[model samples]
Target: MDIDLTRTDIIKIVQYAVGGRVSLIGVNLSGLDLSKLKLSSVDFSFACLKNVIFSRANLCHSKFQEVDAENTIFHDATVSE
Candidate 1:
């Protein structure tokens, strides 16, 4: 299923991931800011993250399997396997 989320909604979801994991599978988040957010262990498998800026964001242990991340920026972002 395709899911659409507003910026505010995305922020809320990231906040909710503070103590756990947030699954954003198959969600289209093209051109979103997504900067400076804490998103540890988040699942973004198959999500469309084109042109999304992840500057300074904490994305440790997050999964981006098969995600469409063309032009996505990860400046200063933390990521792990």
Candidate 2:
């Protein structure tokens, strides 16, 4: 299910989908301005984040396996195990 979502909408959706078990495989959020997001426990395998701005975003416990984040900016982003 591909949805045309704004930056704010993406933030809300990510928040809601992180409650427990959420699989976000093959999601294409390329070129989106997700600079103010706090994502956790979400599986973003094979997702396209090309040219996406993730400044100051909290991406704890999020899986980025096999994802293409080319040209993505992670300025001030806190990534951990």
Candidate 3:
């Protein structure tokens, strides 16, 4: 609940997740502003994305496998597949 992450550093998280063959599994990303980021193909299974803003972000082919997407904003975000 107190995860302090910056936009620049978030790619590290994503890379770590993917590198480890895991991604956003049950992560509490509440109130995060992930807008206009290159987050394509990242897995979000069982993650908590409450109130997260992903506006205009490139989420193409990213997995929302089992997420708590409460109030998550994907406005204008590329979310194909």
Which has the higher TM-score value, candidate number 1 or candidate number 2?
A: 1
The parts of candidate 1 lying over 4 Å away from their true place are: 1-3, 17-19
lDDT of each candidate versus the true structure: 0.88, 0.78, 0.79
lDDT of 1 by residue, 8-73 (tens): 887798776656879999999888888988878889999999888999999999999999999999
Span of ten consecutive residues with least summed lDDT in model 2: 1-10
Q: For candidate 2, what is the TM-score?
A: 0.81
Clashing pairs in model 2, backbone N/Cα/C closer than 3 A: none
RMSD of 1: 2.5
Count of residue pairs whose backbone atoms collide, per candidate:
0, 0, 0
Per-residue error (Å), model 2, residue 45: 0.8
Best by lDDT: 1
Preferred candidate (lDDT higher): 2 or 3: 3
TM-scores of all predicted structures: 0.88, 0.81, 0.80
Tens digits of per-residue lDDT for model 2, 1-81:
343456877666766764564576888878888786776666779988888898998878889999989999999988899
- The model with the greater TM-score, 2 or 3, is 2
Off by over 4 Å in 2: 1-4, 18-21
Which 10 consecutive positions of candidate 3 have the poorest summed lDDT? Answer: 16-25
